[model samples]
Target: MERQRMSTSEELMHLPWWMVLLEGIAALIIGVLLLTSPGMTTLVLTQVLGFYWLIVGVLALVNLFVDHSLWGWKLCSGILGILAGLVIIRHPLWSTLFIPALVVLVLAVQSLIQGGIKIFEAFRGGGFGAVILGILNILLGVVLLSAPLMAAFVLPLVVGIFALIGGVAAIFGAFRLHNSALRASIQQTPT
Candidate 1:
């Protein structure tokens, strides 16, 4: 018998359900922390962003070596991410300019990029929810970019709101993953 290849969604379903739950819980906790202490969160967020970019850059570079299909794009993205990460990490004060406006600008650009990716994924069978999230992220980025000064004042609140929404969505996703895993397990069990 020929073995059938699994779709992306099916492959994802094979992931341990507990990991999804943990991720959801972690997001909820971080969201609450950011909401409760925006001032401190801002500083931490900068460092976090730096580390995140660095890690992603490293992963992308590794992926380029592992999968040569999109090596050029991956190489460019990885180099940019690494450079940005290093610059931000080394001169966070310069990046922020001791002003929240700069931070908002950075976040806006990041959101715009992420939103575009999400939108593309949504078109590729990701689901309507992804489209909605992509639109929202793009709108947030546009709003911040359009009025960066104004965005600085409300940056914390806006971030808080988005974080909460993301947390909730993650939680819901966790449940869905759990259900899928349970069903898969049940189906696999012999009578």
Candidate 2:
């Protein structure tokens, strides 16, 4: 018998419904915590991120042995990730302050570049939608640059609200998926 290959979508569909439910539950908890206590939640989440980076760095280095490909990239990334994680973990308060501001600055630069591209595209007949989007992106970039600290401070609240909404959506979707899977299983079973 020849083996069949499963595409990404098919592979995803094969994941157990309960796994999605567990993910939903975790998201819901994190969302509630984020909303109720943004400051503390952000701090804890940052630490978690640091730990995650550390683990990923170690894993990347280990994977170099399993696969000889891209050793240089892996080695550089692993070292950078480990150093960054250690710095963040060792200086939690400083990390908490610096990371958001860094993110804002990076976003501002990205937005400005994206806006320029969009505007250029519009000039090349991309349409009115592109013009509007380009203008909006430029405006956003300016705003982020002008008050990066303020934006950084508000970032947690914004993220919290988004998380809360996404968590609810995920939970509902999980239930729907679970029911659909159940129905499909019943339909396939012999009576």
**TM-score of each model, in listed order:** 0.56, 0.88
Q: Which candidate gets the maximum TM-score versus the true structure?
A: 2
Q: Supply the global lDDT for candidate 1.
A: 0.81
Q: Give the TM-score of candidate 2.
A: 0.88
Q: How many residue pairs clash in each candidate?
A: 0, 0
lDDT of 1 by residue, 143-180 (tens): 88999877786777677778777878877887899888
Q: lDDT scores for all predictions? A: 0.81, 0.84
Query: Per-residue CA lDDT of candidate 2, range 83-152, in tens?
Result: 8889889988888888888999999999999999999999999999999999999999999999999998
**Residue 76 in model 2: lDDT:** 90
Distance from true position, residue 185, model 2, in Å?
1.4
After superposition, the stretches of candidate 2 with alpha carbons farther than 4 Å from their true spots are: 1-12
